[model samples]
Target: MLLLFVHSKAQTVTGRIVDSEKQSVVMATIALQTLDSINICATTADADGRFVLTADSIPLPFRLIVSSIGYETVMPECASYAVGDVVLATKTNVLGDVVVKSKRPILNVQGDRIVADASSIIKGRIVTCAFDVAKYVPGILCKNDNELSLAGTMSTTVLVNGKVWNGGSVLEYLKTLPAEKVSKVELLYNASPDMHVTGAVINVVLKDNKGRELTGQVKSSYYNNHHNTFQESGSLFYTTPKWSLYSMYTFADAKSISRSQYLSHHTVGNQVYDIDVDARTHSSSLTHAVYTNATYNVSDKSNVSLSYNASFSPKSDTKGRTTNSYFSNSNYTTSGNSYMHNLHLAYVLKQLRLDANYMSYSNDGTQDMNYEKYENPTAYSYWRKQTSDRFNFSADWGFPLWKTARFSLGATYAYSKTGNRQK
Candidate 1:
């Protein structure tokens, strides 16, 4: 008796997916189909846009289907062929004017806090800076682009990545943050004791840049509303496996004009008197702001960071004029220079955190006033200066006590000194 055995080698299909511009299309779907459009085997592209499909036997003259989001679907015929590079064309659809309006849920409850998706809130809205993101967060109020409140609470603290921001002028720090960098915002109404916060908190969680090496952005804007205002800002970020650095600088030159009128009626000793007053104010300022932070990863579960922030207003001037129906007029001019500096150091581990912050601020100004009462010329001049320094340190440790509960303990120390002089 003679026995014969047949040996067969499996068929393998390999290809790389890329867009028309030669950019790798990650996570694209690759499928092997029969001539009748029935799916046979499927695979997905990797980070490098490469895919492999193996089968015990592949039908001759088979079909290959490739598809990806935002790209047109493609199918190519293969007969004893090895697909090398598959270029997919982008898909674009044009339609007539169609109005489809829908509203997304403004807030969602997650665990112990309220969560707001920054991308959802920013979609279809014009958001220029991270401060703008706060405006859209539910239960948060942004006033004058500087003051922030939550649910009628004036004492609100803003944190970035679970760390306190003692930076000079929180507004300046927010301006340096780009809207795209914010992944989501978490609102903690009743913060944990370990947080060392007494009021409502808004924590902005920035997107991770794990695989990115270097990135930067620049922005400039100009507006004219009674006066000209110009602002320019630039930011840079560099990251490696162990070290990351971020820096930003902003400059602003702005001019503004305001007008107001006041009217009052007074009756004294059976005498009726009507008075009217009109006032106008003009102001201009030149400002420069800088912020930088450097972080180093000590291990998989530990890291350390240092940050510095400074804001300087070297030239600022304001002039105002007041006229009264009682035959009195007054004019005043004020000039000032202000600057602030903040430095912070932090060490973070999986279950422990330590922070130290120091800040110094100074403002010096002079005011000149001229007025005419009863046709008599009078002039007054005054100068004032104010300075303050603050230091704070805190430590916190947290651990899981139960499957659904956690225990945290913390301590904080703070000191501040302020001085004011007037002449």
Candidate 2:
């Protein structure tokens, strides 16, 4: 008697789990069940929100059920094999007259950094740009239009996804970033050595667009203060399994008028005199800015990225007039055009990263001033040109040393050249 035994190969299912915001859903449960609802295999998502299920001599048809806390459950049918991304929508519950005395804290300590939930910060508030959200971050102060400080420290560094941003002014770059793209914010008062920063740091983490193919948004704003101001911006994002591209364009036309009065008392040889001066200034500018970034995933743990940013102000003009009680009056007119360009490249492999950046800026302008003292008139004119170029390279590596400690090493190099001419 001859006996022959046949066995079927094991079938494996692999997929990633994410939430509606495209953030990884860790520790999610995954189950493979039969047509009759009998469980065949089960697994849990790993730290990276990936899961795999295998079964020997699996049935012809099966279904996958994915569930997680605070999210809706999803069951997808599979014919032979299942391999893709599964998105889970957040669950909402309606309660009547539910007043809670305690609430969840918005800020949490995560290792050496403080983390703030972006969604919680913007909830019930009208947030247009990332800069607006940054204003709400705890312990942060917007010192000026383009400057941010932490704990009274003026030297603060801003980062995007753990990478230093060298794209002109941080304020302008943040303005181009949509608030909805932010996942969370990390603040480090005493920056780690690996960051290669000397003072406080703010890191903005962006959400992943894994499941979505294309996404875009447009924003327009109008303001009327001393003058009419208009701004328009648009952003586009495209993603594939291994590559992604993002671009943003902004245009602005702004005008401003300011007036000031100064009063002073002067004493010359015991003779007291009072002086009053009034000044008025008007300014206007037109600007265009563009930013683009492209990233390619070499593998699960490694990637390369390139980004470019440019800003051009075609027309900028300022006019001022002053009058004083001492029979002195003056007038000045200034006009200028300025442009900036920045290029950046980066490579990341696990905990090690390398970056290179270059930036160039140029400004050309002319000024004319007229002065009169006691009916004596004088005229002055000057032309000015300024240019600057900067290049920077950095490398950082970080790894865990123990359960509660980490070790980091990094190096940075920078070169700058500037020139200015006035006549």
Error of 1 at 369 (Å): 1.3
Q: Candidate 2 has which clashing residue pairs, if any?
A: none
Each prediction's RMSD to truth: 19.4, 18.5
Segments in model 2 whose C-alpha atoms lie over 4 Å from true places: 1-105, 122-129, 142-152, 267-270
Q: Write the per-residue lDDT of candidate 2 for residues 1-423, one digit (tens) a residue.
A: 999998888778888989888888876656566776655555567777888777674686777777654566787777757657899877666567653221122655556666778897788678877887776665455665566654333467888787776645667767767788788887665577776666668888887656557777788889876899999988887888788898988899999999999999999999998999999999999999998999998988899999999999989999999999876799999999999999999999999899999999999999999988776899999999999999999898889988647888889999999999999
Score each candidate by Cα lDDT: 0.79, 0.78
Q: Give stretches of model 1 more than 4 Å off.
A: 1-110, 117-134, 137-155
Question: What lDDT is reached at residue 345 by model 1?
Answer: 95
Position 331, candidate 1: lDDT? 96
Give me the overall lDDT of model 2: 0.78
**Candidate 2: RMSD to truth:** 18.5
